[model samples]
Structure formats: structure tokens, C-alpha cells
Target: MTSRNTRHHTVLAAAIATATAAALMGTALTASAAPRPTAGSGRPAAAPVALSAAARTGLLRTARAGLARTAEDIGLGAKEKLVVKDVVKDADGTVHTRYERTYEGLPVLGGDLVVHTSESGRTEGVTRASKATLKLATLTPRIAATTAQKQALGLAKDKGSAKATTDRAPRKVVWAAGGKPVLAYETVIGGFQDDGTPSRLHVVTDAATGKKLFQYQSIETGVGNTLYSGKVDLATAHSGSSYTLTDDTRGGHKTYDLDHKQDGTGTLFSQDNDTWGDGKTTNAATAGADAAYGAQATWDFYKDTFGRSGIKNDGKAAYSRVHYGNAYVNAFWDDSCFCMTYGDGTNDSDPLTSLDVAGHEMSHGVTSNTAGLEYSGESGGLNEATSDIMGTGVEFAANNSADPGDYLIGEKIDINGDGKPLRYMDKPSKDGGSADYWTSSVGGEDVHYSSGVANHFFYLLAEGSGAKTIGGVDYDSPTKDGSTVTGIGRAKALQIWYKALTSYFTSTTDYADARKGTLSAATDLYGADSAEYKAVEAAWTGVDVH
Candidate 1:
């Protein structure tokens, strides 16, 4: 995540996302898959458990067929229509289908929901982003759409945005997160930030009152490179005797050189040889190699650890852009481009393309596609924390000897010349700006700081409190309530968090909701009375989220 700017992304329906949402039914629906060795993890992927094309299609059909009844059960009006966003299935035959709602053909912000059902299609529960009843007195706006766009651009310029403007006009949407649903305008502005980072700010304005509802940067911070990871194997493509950074095996993911510019995809890296770098940053291929490795590792981590094929689970690869802006100290993930961009760090010597950084940024795409967490407040904090948690999981799963997995973010990137990490998961408060526990005002803090709560909980649950050494990294995580807690393995904790994120989380899920969702996920994976379930409860309490 951009610790400075934040890890927030906008919701843009890419070609693949649109196709999957409206994909037609297929045949032989089942949960069987051919075993494939994971290049990132070196283990057989969890493909057998992941939903196959047939399975996804069948579930989508079932969900679409029952959409009307599901809306009625959830107390929605006749004008509301459900569009399937994603489908997750467990080995026990439980299904969780996520859907985006529309009111009279206008997209509804914070109208996302997840429907849970049993193997026999019996309703289990439903998670809604907004509990407010849907009823719009009128659809016509009092103000002009051009006015909304102008206001949004003005707001962006006020925030130090250069060349602030939008190519398309503001689109009508229903805002229903914190209060009653109302007609609103969503304006997306493109430009450059004060730091020369690419700008993609989203502004939501109330149509009737001409009041701004919300504004956020869609360029979520994220990276890779020979700068950190030592010599590593990369899935490169060969064309006409030249090897390119394009990886065909893993969703055709490619790495490009931005050539120190702020925008646009630069040149693709190609060489006569596949071996990339000599463990240094001077060679341009060094960062390219790292980015390729990071992408492969992250892809492998998700596919091997959770059976997720890709960020969207559509067997598609998101590309990478490096060498962005001279001395650009930050890296980010842009959902609009479906790519991760890295900047050459201080003096162009330190590239921010560390393994964990890449995992962290790409995980933002995962959150954007799944939970669709808004990039502000408590939900925003969880969004950031989700990246840290999963990014750490990616680092560990990589088992890279050059850069051992640690419970720290951006450690090797050396954003600060003194060799300090961007954030600490074991003791997030160590960073001074981050909160180690939950509080009423936690939601008011910057997402990067408030994220300390969930990050601490994961640390306590996985490694427990007090002194410990893992992968040559020393950690002394503490509990908020001064209570001694027992440790659950990282595998179990990661699984629980992933399940909660996919099956239970919504756009507006706060820390309190997070506690309940994780508990429910644990109950589904393990028994309600199992030790793992109890540990999840204890971990939440230790973080003061109870």
C-alpha cells in the first residue's frame, strides 16, 4: 500500500470482469481440477478445490435464477437487479456468491452483498454492505451532470492534482453506505498527484443537494526486483530466439520499463537470454526480473494457498510497470490498468520492487475484486490490513532465501535510507503513526495507521505475543489487553482470513464486522466449538476489537 497516499483503488469493469459477470452456463459442474506444480511455491496447486469454469458457470446460473427471490428475502424493491461478481465454494459443498446491485439500471454504490447457501442450496446467511431499505423518490437530478464533473475536478485540483479532469461525464449511482440511498454522481478524475504519482481520484456527489459524498485516490500503492530478491527463476516467454519478460504460463503477465516517466506503459524487456540480472539494479533487467518473480510468486501463493487462479480468478494476468518517475519512492496498483507500477527509489538505486511489496500491491486488486472495500474509514483500514496480511503470506510462501519472509512491509526497499520497514505487523505501533489496537477513533486515522489493529491481530494469532524468532527475523508482538494468548499456525490464520474476505466481507465491513466474519469463517472451516475457532475469538479480543 502507499503508506503515504494509501492503498485505495477504483472499481472499473474491465473486459474480463464484464464477461465473467454475464458468462453463460457451461456443463459438467464439479470441483475437480488437474494438478499443476506451482512455480512460486514448488507445491501442487490447490486447483482441485478451486471453482472450475463449469462450476462457476453453474453457480452463476443458480444465483441468477434465484436473484428475484434472494432480493425479496433481503427486502429489496422490484427495481433492484443482482449481477454476480464472484463465486467461492468450499470442499464441504457450501457456496458464497457475491453480487453487485443496481437500482433501475443505475449502479448502486455500497449495494454489494454475499449470499451463502448449503450443498443442497439451502440458505445459510447473507452479508449486505448497506442495511438501508432501497427506495428512491426520483431518479432525475436537480443539477447538471457537467456540474458534478466540474466540482469533482475542482476538488481534485484543490488537493494538489495537476491536469485534473475526466474524459467521461459523471455517471449516476445510488449512494447507500452509511445512510439512506440517494441519487449521486461518481466522477473519476485522471492526472498526476503532488508526488508525480499517477492520479485517479474518484468523487461522489449527491445529485439533489449538490453535496460531495466521498472522494478517494484510485491508485492503490504496491512492487519487485533484482534489487531485493537474489537470483530467481522467472516464467519468461520466448519469441524468435529472444526471451521477453512476458510470462505466458502465468496469465501472460509482463513487465515493462516506464523509463522514469510518470504515465503510460513503456518498453517491454526482451533479451537474447532468459537469465535476467547479476543481482544489481544498474542493469535495467534487474528490476524487471524481480517484478516477474514477484508476480509469479504472488500468483503461485494465491493458487497454491487458496486455489484462487488470479486476482479476479479469471485465469488472466495483470502486468507490471517499473522505472516510474525519477526517484519516485512509492509503488502502486491501479485496477483501471490491472497492473502494478514500481518506482525507482531514492537516487534510483533502491527500486521499490521488493517481493512483499509486489504481493502487497497485487493483493489490493484481490480486495478490489472480492470484498470491494471502500478506501476510507474502518473498511479502508481493513482493506489496507488485508494487503499486509496476504502480502506477508505471499512472502512466506515464496520461501526465498535472499529475502527471508518477515512480518514487516517494505523493509528491503529502504524507503528510508536507514533501512527501516514501512510498517510493522508484529508491533504496528512501533511505527509511531500506526495503532496497535482498536478504539472508537481508529476509523478516523489514516487507513495505513488504523490497519495496525488487524495486522496486530493476525500477528498475535499466528505467532502469539512475546519473543520469537521466525525466518531469522526477531519479533515481540504484544497484546492490547495484556492477556497471554496461544498461537495458531500461519496456514490456519491465512485460511481463516481468506475465507472471511471472500465469503463474508462486504464493501462497508468494519473491524467489528471483521470479528464476526472471521468467527463465522472459522466456524465454517472448523467446528464452532473447535480450538481454532476459539483462537480466532481470543485473537480478536487481544486486539481490543471485542
Candidate 2:
């Protein structure tokens, strides 16, 4: 269900980055990003790629070679090790290599950093998630791992349904996120959350102190197209005088039916006719069409806009599953199966299969693959906001007349029964549960509601501050300091965000880190003196992230 979120190949977009886009030396960084057409401008983006395989390999090699000196500068213990996680480059040949730290080979939570260097391998500056020097007195845990696992599962069962379970027992990790670094156990709980959404809750407990340290759910609420595209052509495969919802061009992406059940991939949709959906929830084909189309559009958006291959940035595509359960009301993306699942809403009348919803859910995959932002605190808010931002981008990129791009999310689904959207970007606070500005307590709220801050920031960055009507919808956006902000256009905003997510952001990146990462990304893409950079600063200020 995306209202919330395709492709033409080779000649697809004129302004987006392609899979083979070369690294052309530019003022922004190293990779070239041709200007993209703004939303509702009836244009598409199909520019060059981010960085070639050789460039990425070179960046990683440079980062690893200088790891000893870089770790020493950060005051790390001799036992600490740095491993390059991902590498991205700029148009000016600047490379940002993300690294994860390990203390005595034990994973260190919140101990990730991005090392920025010039094309000549000269180290510039480092953005560290945590600056703590990890050196524990002992590796043994006073509390048994089984004890921690039981405690975590018990808590998950409390927050989850009766069937709540854990796939793996608690494992040891260095909890360096807050205060002093301590040995802790990280437990992952799976099953349906209390609200019926699938859960990937991570619970961290102190091994020495016998106290729970942290817990977060990775599968938050967030997946497409036939139901929304309105008589559009589908890129399906032909099989024995029939058609199947299998797209080989986009990594053989397929759509399945859960058959009103809660488990498994269900069945693949097939028929004599290639056409799918009537834009109504009358048959199973309608929802299948929507889901398949959503997947296609999302794939195209990433490929054309950012030159992203797929959710994992590999050529492989993630599958989609619909008709998940009876009256399930919500849809979600699950990483365990690398697929999406949807529900039948309101006595199974509404499928929760809106275009934006599909885009929102699938964007969760994008977040998981890139920054892997922790699904808690300010970072979780950013995660949700990223989905909303990308979902909006998906709508615009599709350029569907029946559902043209808008700042409202889930507007077509009638989720609230009052024809109100699940969220509003221009003025997120208008939804009543979201925050309009950043606050210390924002982290404690639900990720969906706390996402309002980043959502408002993106809105200001792309649309500006004040009252206006866009896509036939009314909006009145305000600022924390009552200062006016100008938009830098959605196309540029998307570039800065994608660059930041892939390069500067880490798993524990909070709102503060997001502001910094995006500012740096803007500087890398448009230069420090450009209006886009200034607008990014102003937008974050408007959201009170400063």
C-alpha cells in the first residue's frame, strides 16, 4: 500500500544516476549528479551512476590501509579493530568510508564512524558515532546468556502477542551508546508486535550490571502499483499462454499472495490476461497489481534517481506478498524474508495497498541496507522520516495522473476514516500525533510520530516555509524560530539525502547526526557556497535540529 511510494530501462530518466554512471570530476565531489526535474514538473531523472566498482574498491582499500593511524587518532585501545562497512565517493573525488569498530573482536554498538578523505587518499575528518575508548576489564559475563535471553523474550512477549519468539539467543556486545562502555547482551525477538505489525525487536542487557540497556524494533510500519497506477502497463513475464507477476528485468522481482494467512509467501498471481487490477478491491488481482506496480516503481526510482540497483544495492530484487491477514489494517516490510506483506483493512474492504504505503514500507529496506539506522530514539525517527521522504519521491517519480505526487501520505487509503492521510509533510504536526519541532522528549515518542521533525525539515527543504497549496492540497507550515526558509527543490534534496544516507550516516545516527550528514552531503553535491547548502541549514533550523 503505497500512496506513499518504475522503470524505463537504458533511456529511462534523463537526470537520474544510472547503474553505470561514471565518476566525472565535478565541484561537488567526484560522482556527477545532473540536476533532476522537480516534482509535478512532468520530468524524470536518469543521470550517471554514483561510483564505479573500481572507485568503490579503491576507497575501501585506502580506508583500511590507514585504519591504524585513524584509530590511533581517535584514541582507541590496541585491542580495538576497525572494519570498513561501506564506501561512497563525491563528485570532487572525496571518499567517505564508513567503518564499524570491534573491541577484542566483539561488535561495539554505536562505535561506527565515517572517514572522509580526498581523492589522493589524504584523510580529511572523521564523523564518529561514539568516541569512547573501548577497553573492558573482562570478557566474561556475570549473568548467563540464557538468563538475558529469557528476560528479553519475556519482555517481548509482554509487548508482543502470545506467539512472540526469538530466532537467536542473546549475544555479547559492547554497549558504548551511553555513559561508560559496558559488556552487554543483544537479543533479537521476532513475531507480531502488540499492534499486529511484524516485529524485529532488539533488546540489549548489561552482562555485568544485570540491567537492560536498550531495545528497538527494526520492522516498523512501512510497500505498490496496479491498484494505484490506474490501467497502467505492467512489466510481467509470460508463462505458457498465461501471465505471472514475475519481472525478470528488475532482478526477477515477484509478488505473492498470503491467502489471508499470517505466514509464508503464499501463491504467485497468474492469469490468462496480462492486464491487472480495476483500481477497486473487487478481486485478488487488484491488490496483486498494486503490490507488483509499487515494487516496480520503487525499483525504478532508486535506479533512475540515485543509480541504486535494488534494496540491497545489488541487482537482486526483493519480493512482495499481499492479502496477508483478515482485517489486518496495516502493511509492513520484513527483512528476514527480504519481502513485503500487506493486510486487508476494514472488513477486508480496504487493502491498505496505497501507492504511498507501498513506497513507505519498501523504503524501510533502503534504510536497512544503507545506514541501518537503529530503530529507536532519534535514529528511529529518522528511519521513519526517510521512508516518508522516499515515499513522497516515489509518487512524484511515477507521475501517475490518478495519484500525482503530494506531501500527504496514505491520503488515498482513507486510513483515518475522515479522508485524512497517515502523515503530512508540509506540516507534520497537523496529524495531531507528530512533532513539529525537535525536543529532548521527541526520542521517547513513537517513531512514526517523532518522524514529524525530519518530515517537517524535508518539507521546508523542498517546499519552503509558510502557507501554500500544492497538488490540490492546502498546507500551512511553520518554523520553530519563526524564521522563513526557502526550498532547494525536491530533486536536489533527494540527492543530498541519498548521499548522506549512503556515506555519512551510521546505525545510531540521531537527528543531530542527520543534520550534519545532510549538510555535508549538500556541500559534497552542490558545494558549500550554494543555495542548496544554505537551504539545508535553514530547514534543519526550522525543524529545531540546531
Candidate 3:
């Protein structure tokens, strides 16, 4: 984690400037270029292979175990019905798996839940399944990219003829991090070629060592401009929004609103040659800045804490658009883009573009991309709590000289219409009707407020019981048992939360389930009997969750 003093505004300002300028031309710029085909340009054919009966049964068992573990880490209960319907094996012995399950009795089905098992029968990898494969086999892409290298190549934008004359070829290789190989690529885009071609060379690198592995010219696709928009759609598919309408009320500036010309929900506004949050904004500049900061913060939080990068560990960059619509009152994460949006408050004065709010909103993307948490009841509370935890982690990561880390959300955005933070972790009830602890009735309330129990637990896990100052804010968090619970600090706490989120939680997580997830995650990160583990267990107890 970055120190508060060294980070904060400078890093945020840099991210904003970079993101805003990067968005001006609407082109993709990756760290590397795609590797050219070493063999034939024509599509390759797959060789047929077959699996034995024993192999089939073994693979199915492995898949079931992987699904169970994933569900457990994601806060989905053990009884959520992780059932494997069929398992098919190809000539290479690679397996295609399908399953049917229910989250609180909601029938759900998915496929291609790939699992790699070692000789000892221990699961090695569990990749996310494609919805199309799970929903309809015919809908799956015929040439779907499978490996990390293929995925990285698929993510880059076409650079056109400018890259054709590139004397430099992109390097390609797998970089090792935490014992796993990560595919990395690097390249320049939008630059002039020797012949003045309107393209740039893509460079690929080893994600672990930053080593250049390969380089290649991106094939120009005239539809390049639509690529980002398409990616945005793919990222936000799970998020319930139809379109992103820019807010141009004041001038040419914009706010990425939900629909074209929709009123009442637009988030930020532009004013006085500057972007301020007053419920409406003109462009994605300032809100983009806040979004960039929050995105980077959450990204860094996961990476530095748990050794993961971006949302997919694939070196993917987050997309953020500002100035949503006229007088919008909220910001949101559209799963289709794996990006977040901000809004100026009603009438365009208070933009919900604060760093904490940005983190809060962006975390939703992270959660969606990871656990696919359901958005109702106990699971909903866990989903909300996950956002709050990561949002606080972002503040802590900023280590900003101006805005420090604390238990408050939206302190800078002034969401309350007063000079106060939106929500308080120390005394969550400060949010008017937020619950302070777990109760049966809590599930019936709003997901945000009912999330207090988990939020309070996270705060206590990071800061312990005491009156202290952090990032210029004062907090005197208490314990339900009145027993001092020594925490593992914010950095480690954030790590545990993220691990639990990506590895342990499901859409049905509640307070008690959260307690188990963090504890298990702590044990996994540290040792089962380590101080960190004990602290996590105690922290939940302190919040009356254990």
C-alpha cells in the first residue's frame, strides 16, 4: 500500500490528466502489441483427442470441488446447489464443463467452468465461465480466446497500417508472479510510422518482470472507434442499464448518463471552465479524474494487497465516463464496461465524484467481475459491504496529503448536502437509518444501510478499538463485546476482504457469511494460527458478527 503522504492528490491528478487526455481521441493504448503469427495466417485446426471414463469422472469431481470453493469464497452458501450436469473432453484431454445451481432458489446455469487439476487431484486453476456457453452453446464464440496471451491480444485495439512497417517485433512470454504465469504485452498506438501510416507498434511484455517479450502490428479494423464502446457494453452486461448518454446541457461537456436525455439521475456538471460536483457536469474531465483515482486506487488496493492486477489479472484498464446526465444524483458501475460513472447532484452543484464515492462505485465493477454477487437480501448486504471495504481501501491507498483514509464514505463529495461524510463506519447509525449490527430485520432494509454491520466489522479489523486520526479524520470505533480487538491494519484487512470477495463470496453473502469468508481468507493469506487470522476472527466478533 502507498503511504498517505506520498500519494493523495499528485497521483490522483496524474491519473485524471492521463485518463482525460487518453479519452480525448477514443483509442486503445495497451502496454504492449499483439504477437504476430509465427506460423500460418490461416486459422489453425484442433486435433481430436478423447478422455477415458475415469478421466471424465475425475474431471467432473474436480469441477464440482472448484465450483464449491468458488461459491464458498463468494459468500454463496454451501447448500446453494453446485451440481454438475455434464462434462465433455476434447482430443487434447481439455475439458468443457457445465453446471446447474440455485442461489436462494433462483435457477441458474452456466458452462465452461474450466478447472485444471494436478496429478494429485488438487485443483490448479478455475477460470470464469462464459455466459453464452452456460446459457446457450450455440451462442459461444467460435474462435474464443482462451489463454491469457490470447485474451490480452483480444483486448488490444487495431493500429492500422502505421504498424505495418514496424521493424521492431513485439516480445511475448509468461511472467511469474506469486508462482503463476501472467501474460504481458506492450506497444505504442496512434503514432506516425516511417511511411506515415496512421498506426503504432504494439509491445508485449512479461507481466511479472516487465520484460519485453514480443511485438507486432495491430491489424487495422475501421471499426476501431466502436471497439471501446463494444468493450464497455461487454463489461456492463450484468449491470442494468441500456445506454450511456452524455450530458451536454451547459455546452459541449458531458456526463455519461444511463440513457439519452434522461432526467433526475444525472451525476455531475461543468462550470466556470472547471468541473465541480453540483449534481450536473458538462464533461468527463473532473468526474473522469475522480473515477480514474478511484479506479486506480481500487486496482492498486487489490494488486498491492493480494497481488492481483486490474479486475481480471489480465492487465486490463478500467474505463470511466463523466458528466452522466442533467442533475443526476448518483454514480454507478456498468458491468459491461468494467468502468464506473459519476454524476453531479440534482441541478448540477454536488457531483458524486469524490474519491471514496468513486472507489465505492468502481468496487461494484470488481465485485461483479469476480463473484457476480446477487443484489438482494443477505447477499446484497455483502455486495454493498464489499464496496465499502474496497472504497475505504482506496482512500487508504491514496495516502493523499489532502484527503486521508478514514471510515467515512463520500467525505469529499458532500452527499449529505452538508459539510459531512455520507456514511460513518464508527457509528453507522449516523446515516439516519443505517443498522449498526446484524439482525433478522436488517435484510429487509436497503442494502446500503444494512451493510453497516459488515462495514463496521471491516473498520474494526483495520483500525482496532480507539480514538485515532487517519487521513485528517477522527474515528473512535467501538467493539460490541467491549473487548479490544487488535487489527491487522488497513492494508492487510483490505487484502483479506478482496481475497474473500474474489475467492470466497457469492451473491447471497450476509454478515455471518462475511465473517467466515474474511477469517478463512486471513488464514489463507497468513497462517491459520497466525496473528492475522486471530485478529480477523476477533474483529468479526467485535462487530457482533461471529
Candidate 4:
């Protein structure tokens, strides 16, 4: 989810054919150099596991009991009481219960953790984002709410437009960073930025000293395009006299028009007829049509490819809002509303409503429900990359000629006004800002640019290292280690990545953890010594993640 424009242009000359042949030869040589093992190459297929009735009841009872025993069960201090936030029982009979910590009736900000238990109530493991103990000197804040609010507003003004407004009151909470916990006030400020970008800033300030603790923007921006998807059939609900943009096939997913407004659910799109759009932005229904079609395709892709029911796997669809803000240049998926919002690009003629963009934004919801990756640092990079990878997978799965699948992200949007993509998976550094490979300092880079490491790894794992044509798009990938990689094909590659994301990844997983997670996933799906597993290892090594 990178909206930053790129100035570099990719030159795809006819000489790529020769490079493609050489790359293929290198891959062949690499494969010949190390023959694959066959003994542990495949696993016996097993049926999906299910939780027993007694296990479900036990988990429910544990959840309803305030989860107070979790502290002792998971080896926490007596002062730490975990409140259950969510309880998810996996198909393998593993119960994962998420919790938030409160110390002496005060909430701990970074004290959230997930406890994994077996069906027999045996503790398996725990995943915690912070290792620091929740101990604070005082519960009362020295700073007044009014002063905190003013400080937050001033900070927002410094980073945003002059017209930005702050209307919400500050909230008191514990600020936890670097293993230290202190009383703090959380302030939220929202409005349009000076550059016309939307802002949803969350600022934290120390309540005792009035020092700024941290700040993060809630608005996640990325790039898209309407403006064309060819003539296609749409799923609409027919009322007495008109058709509504609701798809019954996909849990009644609907598309709405925000009419340049920023908040609340907009109006449902309806018309007397089913036909929509003329491949132009002049018609309002045109953007809605593209949105509806994109949602349908994304829904079908997830269900057909991964057997996932919906974003939460709850057999429910998330709605979409189009034409958000005036000349808005981005789109985002907000979990608070459980919906996706699109904006009209510069001048209102370029709406950010495309198939892959839809998939990308929706995948964020999927990631939230699954791994719950924290949106910062290396984990944040992984979060963004997961969307890009899965979104690209959806595009290929759709196989639509109007928007053929490619590794190039936001290619149709012209977000940079140069007709180049926002990112290039084969060689991410081509975007100028993105990293070509992983490094020790990668976590310090912007999540969008740090995401390039994983994107490059996925490209190598799926298509190998060299020049290749996929979905009518040419890609020339190079390895950081100058080693040739033999791909396991996109299908198998996507399978491994999905398995890792849903089953193994956690909120604080880094690049090294990701390598282990993907390898373990490949082993589970393929085998411990399978070619796919070896390829996963090689691909990570190619990205300098080892």
C-alpha cells in the first residue's frame, strides 16, 4: 500500500528475450547443481481437524470466566489481569485467545497478547508484542485534559493542513515503549492535510511531563484507476422497479457513493437498468460499476482460491464506498467500519477503483483477522507486502483481459502521472525509494519501501530470478547474492505464503521470523525436504534475508 509516486521509467526493450533465455539457463544450472531429495518430499493428505463439542464448551467457559486465570496459566505477575478480546478456535483444535492487560484497573497499551492452548486445555505458547512488565508509579495524570488536547492539536497542525480540525476529547491510557510504562493521553485529530491527503493522526503524550510519546497516522493511502475494466456482467439486486448494486452471490456486498463526503456510509447505488458505465469518468455509475465488479472478483478469488468465506471467514461481505473526498488521491480499508473506501484521483476524473486495488485493500482486513500484524516496523512491512502479494494473486486469478495480472502494482492508475507503476516486484528498487533487498536497517525505512524486500522474495519464489513474461508483462529480476533461483510456480508459492500468514505469523514477526514461517508452511503443505521448501529457503537467501 504505497502511494508515493516514482519518477523512474522502466524500459522494456526487445533484448529482454536474450536475457530471458540466459536466466532460464541459469535456473536450469542451479537446479542441476543441487538435486532435490525425494524421501520427505510429500506428506499424506489429512482431513481438516475440528474442535470437539466439549472443547468448545470448555473454551467458552474459560472466556466467560474473565480470563483471570490466564495470568497464572501463562506465567504473569499477580498484578496483571488479562481481559479476553477475542477467541478463535482453529480447524486443528488449537484455541487462540487474544487478551489485553490491565494493571490495578489501569489499561496497559502494549500489554496485549495471544495465548495458544490445545483442545485439552494445555497451554501451548503465547505471542506477545512486548516483553516489558506492566508496572507504573501513578494512575493519576499531572496534565489536564484541556492542556493535553491543546498540545495534540498543535502537533497535528504542524504536520497537517491549516484547516485541520480536532473535535475528539483526549483519552487517558498507559504509554508503553522501550519496556517503560507511564501515564499518557491519547488524542485523535482528523482532517485534510496541506497536500490534500486525508489525516487521521493518533498522538500520545506523557501526562506527567507533557512530553510527546508517539504518533501514527490512521489513514493508510495507496494508489488505483477506474477508468476501464471493459464490458462485464455485474451482480445486482432487483427491486420492484430498479436494480441495486448488491451482490447476493457474495453475501450481499454492496457499493455506495460517498459524494465527496469523508464519513458515514454513503448512499446505495440504484438505477432503473443493470447496464453501467461507458469506460469514462463522466458517469457516476461508472465508478460504482467498477467497484462492484472489483468486489465480486476479489470475493470470488478469495473463496475460490483459498476457500475463505470472507474477510473474517464469517460468511459476511464488507461494503465499498466510492468517490470519497474532493480529488482524493488514495483509498483505504478501515477496520472500524469494516468497509473499503475509494477516492477520485486528481481533478475527479481518475477514480482509484481497480481490481487489484480492491483486492489489496480488502486483504488488509484479512490480515487483521488472521495474523493481526502490528502496523509498524518490519512487521508493518510484512503487513503491506502481504496485501500486495495476495492482491497480485487475485489479479492473476481473475484473468481479465481488461486488467491482466501483473507484478506491477497500480499500473493502470498513473499515480505518478508518468504511466509507471507505484512498485515493481521483480526489482523493487526501480521505484527509487524501495529497497532491493533486506538489510539490518530495513526496519528503519518506511514500511512501504521496506516491503520491497518481501515483494522481491515473492517474485523470485514464483517466477525465478531473470527476465520473464507473465500476463503480458515483462519482468527482469536479479538476486542480491548473484545466485540463480528456480521457481516453484506462482500457485504453489501463493499457497505457502497464505499458509504462513494465517497459521504461523504473529504481530511482531520480522524478516527472519518470516523466513522460518514460510519454510515451515512450505514443509506443511509440500514436505520437510520438498523442492518447494528448498525453494523458499533459496528465495529468502536471494533477498539477503538469511
How accurate locally, in lDDT, is each candidate?
A: 0.78, 0.74, 0.47, 0.71
Best by lDDT: 1
Q: On lDDT, who's better, 1 or 3? A: 1
lDDT of model 2 at position 47: 19
Q: Which stretches of candidate 2 lie over 4 Å from their true place?
A: 1-48, 51-76, 223-225
Task: Count clashing pairs, candidate 3.
Answer: 86
Candidate 3's residue-wise lDDT over 1-546, tens digit each?
Answer: 101221111101000000001001111111111111111322111111234446656766777778767455433444354555444332223343434454333333221122323335434344332211111112122221223234333333332232233233333322211122233333333343222212333444444444443342221100001100110101111114332222221111223434323223344322233222222244334344444345545666655555444554434555555554556555655443444555455566666666667667666666655554444455555666777778777777767655667788666765455676667887777767667777767777655667778888888888887788765677788777788977667766776776566544443345665666566556545556668778888877877776
Tell me which of candidates 1 and 2 scores higher on TM-score: 1
Model 4 CA deviation exceeding 4 Å by range:
1-66, 83-91, 223-226, 523-527
Superior candidate under TM-score, 1 versus 3: 1
Give the Å shift of residue 269 in candidate 4. 0.8
Ordered by TM-score, highest first, the candidates read 1, 2, 4, 3
Give the CA lDDT, 0 to 100, for residue 54 in model 4: 59
lDDT-best of 1 and 4 = 1
User: How many clashing pairs does model 2 include?
Assistant: 44
Question: Which pairs clash inside model 1?
Answer: 222-332, 224-353, 225-290
Return the lDDT, model 3, position 535.
Answer: 88
lDDT of 4 by residue, 31-141 (tens): 001121232423212101233445545666777584767688877777778776545564445566766677777666656566766667777666564555667778888
Question: How much is the lDDT of residue 56 in candidate 1?
Answer: 76
